[model samples]
Target: MCRGLDSLPITCLERAKELRALFGSFLQKSDHNLKKSEKLKLSDVKELLQWKESFDHLLSSQNGLCLFRAFLVSEFSEENIAFYLACEDYRATKASKLAPKAEKIYKEFIDSDAPREVNLDYATKAVTKENMEQPSQSCFDEAQAKIYILMEKDCYPRFLKSSMYLELTRKTRTG
Candidate 1:
């Protein structure tokens, strides 16, 4: 039997397969990859520094979100970011999924025994649990806003002072 010209030896085929896998994983156009390819503009850094209202804009950007998450991680407050994101995603969930999703979120982040509990006040936590009796899109609103404000007032300042954020500013200015 004659093999097609496009066919290769088993060793060559194995090498090609390995290379394909490597490129597939390494070069995929993910948020991290996009940030790596396109550095933050100097104006972006300026807005982040000068505009207090622009924290929402910063969180909306992939690189900014990643940088803020890194800051949270360093401060051991990553759970706050995780809970805030979970709430954001929960807001868009389908009506039919509201109950179970709310339950899961409450158990994960609001419950006293949660593995990643957020620092909510007793009243807010109790109200959230009561809301779980009839889960809805607004069930987590209060808790979420508290977390958002906490980050805006507390974490945001610390993040700006972080060396990672400082390095980013330096790169945007010089490079």
Candidate 2:
């Protein structure tokens, strides 16, 4: 009985050490991610603080884009990010790959029955479908610009008002 009692403390000490190591590792990863996220440029911060600045200007910065992308994710509009990224990728497509890639982008985001279709209007969708017949670098120009405007006018303001944005701003100010 005395031996059992003596070993109990040793077992607890070992468990405590294991738990501490796990917690330390978690903190380290968390800190790393936070640092990565905190790489916002000072000019981006200035633009974000300027209420009258165009949301397009805010998104021109990598950090601003990251923050806005995170905000869109939180609002269950990750599709916006997908569409935006797809357009960006489309712009870089080579002439040889243009047709297939354009079709894929349309089927994924512009198709009426697409699983991840964005909120494009009927006219723009029709125009995008027409553009697919002759895919060019400008094929998705109209649709991408509309989506950009939508995020700017709608999502950007809400993002600024979100508690997450508020907390991030507060941290930026203090840190």
lDDT tens readout by residue for model 1, 1-175: 1122122234544543443343334334343455643334334545444423567876877556655665576677878888898999999999999999998999888998887788899999989999999988999999999999999989988887777566545444443
lDDT value for candidate 1?
A: 0.71
User: Candidate 2: worst 10 consecutive residues by lDDT?
Assistant: 1-10
Q: After superposition, how far is residue 17 of candidate 1 from its true place, in Å?
A: 27
After superposition, the stretches of candidate 1 with alpha carbons farther than 4 Å from their true spots are 1-53
User: On residues 1-175, what C-alpha lDDT tens digit does candidate 2 reach at each position?
Assistant: 1122232234444543443343334334433365544434444346545532667665676445655665565576757766887899989989999999998989878897776778999999989889999999999999999998888778988988886556545554554
List per-prediction Cα lDDT, in the order shown.
0.71, 0.68
Q: Cα lDDT for residue 91, model 1?
A: 94
RMSD of 2: 14.8
Q: Clashing pairs in model 2?
A: none
**C-alpha lDDT of residue 24 in model 2:** 35
Query: Whole-model lDDT, candidate 2?
Result: 0.68
